[model samples]
Target chain A: MLILECPCCGVSGEETEFHAGGEAHLKRHSVGSTDDQFEEYLFMRENPHGVHFERWRHNNGCGKWFHAARCTTTLEVFGTYCAQTYEPPKEIKDAISARRPGWSWRNFS
Target chain B: MFEAVSALQGASFNAGIAEVRELGLRGMITLRGDLTDKKLIKAVKGIAGRIPEPRTVALKDDDGAAWMSPDELLLMVPHADVLSTIETLNASLKGTHFLAANVSDARAVFEVFGPHAREVMAKLAPVDFSPDAFKMGMFRRSRLAQVPAAFWMNEEDAFTVVCFRSVAEYMFDLLSIAAQAGSEVDAL
Candidate 1:
């Protein structure tokens, strides 16, 4: 019944066509060089309310992944943007890019 | 405007395929993008003159409806110029963050007109079919038998219902039911 606006498809379709991808901009922790440190970094989350980012998938239409921001209570989507272009907040981006004392994308990949 | 199909008179449906007998009345262009793209915004403004007002229909001089949003807008224009309009709008854009598509084939529309159109709508749609509740030239997303559709009344007694192509057959069935109900109600 709710007309969900798909950022990629450019149409207001039934919410059935879309699959909420959960919080959109969850940043991965920097590589922590050591095995124990990396494991801890891999599993952490701060599910905060009040202006949080979430991911949504256009499962029925374009088959693309995207991100959106919404109110936790009312489901008023404030903004939607492509996941590819998602620019995490400066603080989070910096924290992840720093790569701790010795971590990188290779360890997990 | 969808092509009017053979009406099943025994059923309660008034097919609006009559409206699409030629080309169609409304030419809908779908625009998708991140609202943050200034270039895209500027390009749309350059062509359309002004962006659609938020969550409302923005009508320019032409009989077009720009259903505005935080990210997407459906630009409805006179059906004849759909191809040209898409080209012009896309040409004006310098950025690659958005796509403007002429999806005339993807949707089937019903241009239901006449005095009893509202009566037929009541049975077809769940929302109040009153002129005051819907007003003229305003659209809302509703369903014709659980199918997603956009409905709006342009002039008094003239309503337009647009739905995706996949559900067109199902909608037509429901329209028949509503049309029959409309005639029955009129007799009373």
Candidate 2:
């Protein structure tokens, strides 16, 4: 049972109380974009073994969506932050980098 | 004029450890806005006596308010006062970006009263029902088995649960099963 804390409501609950909304920080490819870009936007996902960022909804609680940083292998959550950001917060990125040195995701290291 | 009816028409169950009864026709209003705004707080205070803290409730008699989220509060009043309460809130918060809607008929309420009432709640929700953790005034919105529900302690050995009217029977049955005789966890 993976436990996640919703930053919006500050409630820590099991995965059953929340809904996983796939990867986090995806740039949309709207009209006039190339078909490949659109397909990549819709289908491409990062399934990293460690230090992954994902979107989650506090489905049963606050009903607000937020971002979570955790390890896919160990399920060690680095942190959770508000969902209205384009990238993970600096503290979360620093926390991930402290544990996994020389690590990089998307643009942040 | 039209007649109003409650979801369950006052269904009740007794299972030795606890008694579950459908609380008929409660007035509920879903108010979404800046909880910290002076005008909003004053408007809510006029109805509930005070604004509730995070994940808590501020109640007085049949009227009170429960914090539902960062930007939402559930206002409780007498069934006959729902419309008037909303009108007052709207008039008070005219310039604010807020929403106050009457949700009385859209929901169902139940009461669990007994020595083991916390146990019955613990069985269904993924919450800490221990006395030290869940005290009076602390409200929680969580799942009751397969449905979304919110509950809070109203007395030392009693809890009030609220859920959508569509699942009133399901919630009642779930509570009944959880409070069934000889099915006690005896932990909390």
Scored by lDDT, the top model is 2
User: Alpha carbon lDDT of residue A50, candidate 1?
Assistant: 38
lDDT of each: 0.59, 0.93
Per-prediction TM-score: 0.53, 0.96
Candidate 2 lDDT tens digits, A20-72: 99999999998999999999999998878778889999999999999999889
Q: Candidate 1 residues B1-188, lDDT tens each? A: 76623222112334442221111345778888865677766756654666655435555666455553456777777667888877876776645778888876677676666677787676655556665666765666556656767777667876767777666667666665566432546421
Tell me what fraction of the real C-alpha contacts between chains A and B each candidate also makes.
0.00, 0.79
Local lDDT at B63 for model 1: 43
Candidate 2 lDDT over B1-188, as tens digits, reads: 99899999999999557999999999999999999999999999999999999999999899999999999999999999999999999999999999999999999999999999999999899998999999998999999999999999999989999999999999999999888888877898
Q: Give per-residue CA lDDT, model 1, range A1-109, as digits (tens).
A: 3355666655455566567766554455465467655665566543544345667876654456777655455655545666785364444334434533232221210
Clashing pairs in 1: A21-A55, A23-A54, A24-A53, A24-A54, A31-A103, B3-B17, B4-B17, B12-B176, B12-B180, B13-B176
DockQ class, candidate 2 = high
Report chain A TM-scores, every model. Answer: 0.61, 0.94
Worst 10 residues of 2 chain A by lDDT: A100-109
Model 2 spans with C-alpha error above 4 angstroms: none
